[model samples]
Structures are given as structure tokens and as C-alpha cells.
Target: MKKIMFNDKFSLTQAVLEGRKTMTRRIVTYPLKFRGVNVAGYFVCKRPSGEVTEICMYDEDERMIDGGQILPKYKVGEVVAIAQSYKDLGYDPDSLDRDPKDLGIRGFMKHSAGWNNKMFVSAAACKKHIRITGVKCERLQDISEAECLKEGIEEHLKGIQYGFPSNIGYIGQYPFSNPREAFSALIDKVSGKGMFASNPYVFVYEFKLID
Candidate 1:
């Protein structure tokens, strides 16, 4: 699979409208803190052909509320039409109509409707140091949203080294302002360091949220 790279100058909304599927390259350009609030960031998606699209909260909402700004190097309108073509073909993630939470914190919910799981570690440790801190596979067939959270918390407590047992005692028990913040904090804790380290990539796993 091709890796996604960030294009500081692109407009995610225009790319989606042009019909280009967003690539999977994601980054955090700023010092983002998961304060259990509704925070957002930009991500870069790499097309199969190696072209990069910088998709962000702007693509889904048409505005940036988190003090983020578009990169000045790339032209926002240059790839609008090409991106629109991708959208016309139904390749956009935003068009799926599911709540962002339903997509899972790291887009892992798409693989298993019953349970979602992910692990994060240094890229160098991907094979050896990578750890699966959370798992939600206890009851795949009839899981409630509350139960899913409980399983995640249990897994975190079992595998993670810090923060999990101290801050979050049980799944779905934290008073996060939003799911994103809670998920972000979990990623940080599991990674055993800050989230934007040059050599680390947090593995994200997610399961379908039962209605």
C-alpha cells in the first residue's frame, strides 16, 4: 500500500467535491492536546497514483474552527475538479452519512461491525514493541455501545503502562467532552509518549457502535 503524504496547500472540501477519495496519510502539525473536547485536525490522503490530498475538518464542514490554517504553498483550487470526480464516483469518506464516531477513531470500524481494536507504538517497534492495549471482542454479536466502551477500558487497563488505570477506570466511564478527545488521549497513552513523535505511529482499532 502507498503511504499518504501531507499537502499543506490543498482544500479538503474542494477535493471531496471533485470526487477524489481521501488518502490515508494523517498528521498533527500542532501540539494537540486531547482535553476531551471537540477538537479537529487535517490529514493527507495518498491516492493510488501517488497524488496527495490534504483533507481536514474543512472538507467536512467547510471551515476551520480550531485555529488551523491552510498551507500557503499549495493552491486550494488547483485540484478541485479532479477531487470532484472522485466524489461523483462516491469515493469520499464524508459522503458515507455515518456519524464520525461510527467511523471509529482510526477508521477501523469498517473492518468489523461487531468489534474494533488498535495498537500504537514506534514504527521501529512495529514488529516487536507494538502493543494491542485495547480489544473489544468479548461479545461480537450483541454488543451495546456501553459494553464496547467497557471492553476497551478493560483492555487498556490490562496492557497499557500508564494513565489508563489512573485517569480512566472503566470503559465509557471518562467524562470526555467528545469521543475524539477521549480517543486521542487513549492513543497518546498507549504510544507511551507524545503522539507526534517522528518515529512513532499509533495503531488504532475500532468496532461498530451498536445502535
Candidate 2:
């Protein structure tokens, strides 16, 4: 089994637990003098041997950049644990049948009193697990309109969108205008500042909660 973590600030972990978020993306950069593409292009590229394939990145100016191997941490169909903070675990030390044991907190001491970071949470303690259903490579900005929603971009909708009764056209009011822009802001927070502007290559993983 593998482990995947999300930011608590954005309530992403909560979203996954509620079955709202089904996909995630992680950036991959070419070390030293390597960089990359836009409008979320997808191309089927084959190497000279016709055995290897890769997605080429393009800059804003439309110049092609060769992105080195885009490797993913988890594979399709693999079961992965969704990490959670110890405080979020709902652990009741007083109610447990057994005595207190190491919960895998990094600086945890018997007398210490603080919540454990999600990264330190052990596999056995993970209450939520997801199974990878799909994986693909794409540039950060290449995300589709639908993909943005899958990334768990929060949307607050006002009723009566475009004077129509349908719920599909409601405008989002979650600080940002719509899903893609909101997702751009989110990736930067998750990855780092300027990551969205750089439009780096990324591995997108689609998954579903199993527990």
C-alpha cells in the first residue's frame, strides 16, 4: 500500500472523505537547466524505437520542451492510504481497551501535548484509504474544466444561474471565479509559490475511496 496526503487548510482531506474529490496532481521538474507547456495539450508521442512514449511540454510562446521521465508514486489499481492528523483521527486514549502505545508522532513524548502531523501518521492508523483508478501526465495549466472539479476545487453557487433553472450554469463564488482558476491557486499552495505560473509537468492520479 502507498500513502497520499492533502492539506487540511483547504479541507481537501474532508472532501475526499465526502467523495467530492476523486483526483490529484503532483508536479515533476527536470533538474538543472530543464524546464517546460499550455491550454492543457495532450499528445501521443512515440520514440525512435516506438517502445517509449512521452508528453512534450510547450511554453507560453509555443516552444516545445522535452520533459524528462514523468514517474508516478502510485500505480493504477493500487490501494493507497489517505493520511490524517492524529487529532483528526478521533483517537480516544482513555477509551481504548489497551494501554497507550506509540502513535508514530515524530516528537511525541509521554508528557507532550500536541497533535501529530499527518505525515507521521502510521498506515494502521489511517481511517481513510483510496484505490487508484487512473493515472496520466499533463502540464499544470493543461487541466481541463472537468478535471478542475475532480481536483476538489471548491465552488459556492448562487441560485438561478444565467436565468435558467438548471444547476449546471451557476457561477462559482469561492473567492475565485471558477474551477480552473481556483485550482490554479490551490496547486500553488499545495506545491509552492509560482508553480502554477511555471506550468510544470505533473502526474494526475484519479482515485476512489475504499474505506
Task: Please name the candidate that would achieve the greatest TM-score relative to the true structure.
Answer: 2
lDDT of 1 by residue, 151-171 (tens): 232223432334443443332
What would the TM-score be for candidate 2 when compared with the true structure? Answer: 0.68
* Pairs in steric clash, model 2: 37-58, 40-142
Q: Which segments of model 2 are wrong by more than 4 Å?
A: 29-70, 94-114, 159-174
Query: Backbone clashes per model, in order?
Result: 21, 2
Q: Please list the C-alpha lDDT of all candidates, in the order they appear.
A: 0.28, 0.65
On the 0 to 100 scale, the lDDT of residue 53 in model 1 is: 27
lDDT of 2 at 157: 55
TM-score for every candidate vs. truth?
A: 0.19, 0.68
Which consecutive 10 residues in model 1 have the weakest lDDT in total?
122-131
